[model samples]
Target: MKKKNKKLEVRKPNQEVRLASNVYIILIISFYSMIGIMTLCSLMLLIGIIAFKTNNLPLFSQIKTVISTIMIIIVLMFLILYPIKNTIEPETKLEKDAFIFALNRLGLKSKCELEKLNGIIHNLKRDRLHFSSESDLYRIYLLLENGQMVDYLISLRDLKQLIKIGQKVKIRNSNLKLPISGWCSDHLSISVIDEEGKTFYKFESYEPFNNKTKLKGRKIVG
Candidate 1:
């Protein structure tokens, strides 16, 4: 009886662990299911509203109430998921090395020298969608060699920065055109001109590259 009781007690913890894992799995499934349902409902409701207005259907007030409720639920979901959204995963050492090699091959050797800045890239997030032209949308978090963390927002195109340099060179009044193809390179060199059209600072950083495959598959490294 004693041995049997001990065996049962041992099994109890295993059962509890299994139960907890099952509950967590269920929670994840339910959360995603709710998101899908909510999204579908919202899309359907939007279509209904358009149809009602287009065909002059009645019961518009009822539709408005349903739309408003869905909007609130979506807002609440966004708030709940906001913490994890846009969170970037860090690259492994091997991947980072491969990325540095790629950048070096692209002739951005100076910028790849993170040690000079006493910083190591902790995480990097690239813009999957071409959303903004004015802002540095791509984000890179750096862990300083001194143990401090900082982030750098780098631009996709050098057009704006190059134009600013042009302004300083008294070329602001002159219509200057740069090849659209040359405007964006993720790892390329840029030569800035001074007031006398002399080459000023020429270095490399995350600018823009026209390689769609390279840009889209940035996260995958061998």
Candidate 2:
């Protein structure tokens, strides 16, 4: 039981980011749509009332005041509420923390520099529809060094990260301290920026490129 409990669960990081991004977009669209519908309905009602009471001086002033007050209230509500809504907590924060723990156990490479370099992608296979709910294609590939495949699976958010099979990649370094080493270990972290200036974050888990047959089966045919 202890052995089973200690097993580390590996999760794909880009998937979580994609899911969180989609959720954020959906929430924003829904909030704005509701606000628009409500505003339009209120405006129509106010306009109808003013049209009917055009000759009443007191009624016209009261109606105008009500509309102005409502407009101010809506503006204030957006000013107060939008920031709070947009400040939603990171959905993958826990996963990222857990990953840091696993990395601590993996041990830092004394001379192992994973931080920054330029390289090529020799074999890349991606599946967007492997799961019906996911927004981005699932990518699994390896970095190439002098035509030799790197032993570890490399993951990034977009295809632009590895556009052509022989295209060069410029990798930069990032560091995050996690609780595994007294919460102070600085692990190698990275994010990629393509030629088009779009960014893709480094994924959490890495897998051995051991299944040659499976890897070949996943390759895109020309």
Candidate 3:
């Protein structure tokens, strides 16, 4: 008796629904960011008026109280400021969801070996590398264009499957994921990860990129 060869697949839910959810998420974030900005502006106006109405330079305690109040307001404003916010946000999750959605829409299903997966990652010219540590086990790279973007994923994990950078390849399977547009790394680096969520395989990228690809054509150092 022989064991059946199972094809490894990368599947996803309906894209239309995912995209609608992303749009709704972005709109909600925009609303909150707007509210934050307006609140910040009103606080600044109030501070300016209080400063302008100052009649006499009084006790040092009064100055300290005023400064403390300004600091408190500024800190509160930053709790909602999208730009410098360090906490996880709905918008941030939406970005990840959108990336995952695009990866599925691009039709990434691989029954091939891990070598082929590596090749796909090498050819795409991605501007960013998006990995999910939450639900899906995948690595997606992307590049933006015309308010749209292109991307791909990696889901291979066989010990014998290793491809060197710049290694020649004959690309087939248009659905294969690759990262081609991203900036090259300054140093040689290798990563070791659990194979098939069990055994580990160590791989290296020669001069691979080392930052998050910010939207609107900028690379923000991570």
Candidate 4:
């Protein structure tokens, strides 16, 4: 009897539910920023009133200068601290629940269908020599509507099973034309047609995108 081959399992990447935590974080930052602005304005008004009433006395002048300096420092601190706060705060259960609710509202299932795209693979390149990481080893290049070609990154492990260069393909739930779009990398299914018939190849961890895709551009639907 012949021995059977075992399939390899790719570990799912740990991606944050950014929309959930971002909403709370933005609200917190905005609230504190507004408060700081109001307080600074009040201090400035007090200084102005004192200067006007006292006819800009020597002592009042010095006090006003010190207060102005303090106000500038506070504004600088606000700029620095808010960004740190955004990163340090952990996502709570409420945020996670809200994210789930949002997904449900949008009618998107986990690794489910969203849209279908059709395009020809303009080019494909594999640069194993210069890249420092395995993920950067392979890329499927596609020509955009504006006559510019963009390289979409893919894992080197899935390079063999993916669509070939110059092949006309109908891709589901992926938009290569957009600068950034949602791609379900974990569950990839590609169909190839030839003179013989149609053949389907299902793969795991095969999308041509990384986590930075979400941060660089707009992909609100995913």
Pick the TM-score winner: 4
Ranking of candidates on TM-score, top first: 4, 3, 2, 1
lDDT of 3 by residue, 39-127 (tens): 87868865774676443656675577577767876776656554433221222333333433433444432222121122222332322
Candidate 2 stretches with Cα past 4 Å from truth are: 1-13, 59-69, 72-84, 87-222
lDDT of 3 at 8: 26
Best by lDDT: 4
Query: Which ten residues in a row are the worst by lDDT in model 2?
Result: 208-217
TM-score of each: 0.26, 0.29, 0.30, 0.39
TM-score of 1: 0.26
Error of 1 at 3 (Å): 46
At residue 70, what lDDT does model 4 achieve? 66
Return the lDDT, model 1, position 10: 14
The TM-score of candidate 3 is: 0.30
Question: RMSD in Å for candidate 1, one decimal?
Answer: 22.5
CA lDDT, candidate 1, residue 49: 58
Overall lDDT per candidate, in order of appearance: 0.38, 0.41, 0.36, 0.44
Whole-model alpha-carbon lDDT for candidate 2: 0.41
Residue 190 CA displacement from its true place in model 1, Å = 42
Candidate 1, residue 63: the lDDT equals 69
